[model samples]
Target: MTSLSTSKLLALLALFVWQAHASLANSPRSLPARDEFVCPAEDIANTGCLGPKDCLYANPNNCNTFIRCIANADGTGTPVVLPCLLELEWNDNKKECDFPENSTCPPK
Candidate 1:
């Protein structure tokens, strides 16, 4: 390839790398073993899920205060390290996890 073309390609590659790094840094922090789960510190009281199987009581202490625990294979509870269960987002006003689509979060 021509020297100019090579240089342009390299520059583009560098820009892509930089943008990827920035995006990752700005993204929400995921759990250690489960990356699909992201728990923001502001909305979490602890790093665990709550459910029937995981917890002796369903929705212990009104887990609604934080994220809802993940469900077991049979639909029980499994305490996870993530603040909220997968897909459930934190609702600041409601002070709990809720459906993202139903949430009143400002549009991106």
Candidate 2:
């Protein structure tokens, strides 16, 4: 009698553990983010304002330029804005984003 009761108790405990683990594994935080901010030419949709995840992205072909999605203040999204971060500038020859300290851009 005791053996059967103990076995049933263990089964119930195992079931409870399995349920807890399953819920956590399927939680919302485990899901992937749908919005991604692409730099320069990679604007998903020009919204003018950058989302929380928006930031400078590396471009191997343009060291001085990055693919950034800048938000427009007028509430109309139609342009692709390419602004270099801090000290970095777009380099046409390197095909990658580069810092200005180590390189100089010709006066425009």
lDDT of each: 0.44, 0.46
| Residue pairs in collision within model 1 | 49-79, 49-80, 50-69, 51-77
Weakest 10 consecutive residues of candidate 1 by summed lDDT: 52-61
Worst 10 residues of 2 by lDDT: 25-34
TM-score attained by model 1? 0.29
Residue-level lDDT of model 2, residues 17-92, one tens digit each, is 7786456423423112213322333343442345633433443344444443344544433223244544567554
What are the models' TM-scores?
Answer: 0.29, 0.27
Q: Identify the candidate with maximal lDDT.
A: 2
Q: How close to the true structure is residue 70 of candidate 2, measured as C-alpha lDDT?
A: 46
Q: Any runs in candidate 1 off by more than 4 Å, and if so which?
A: 30-108
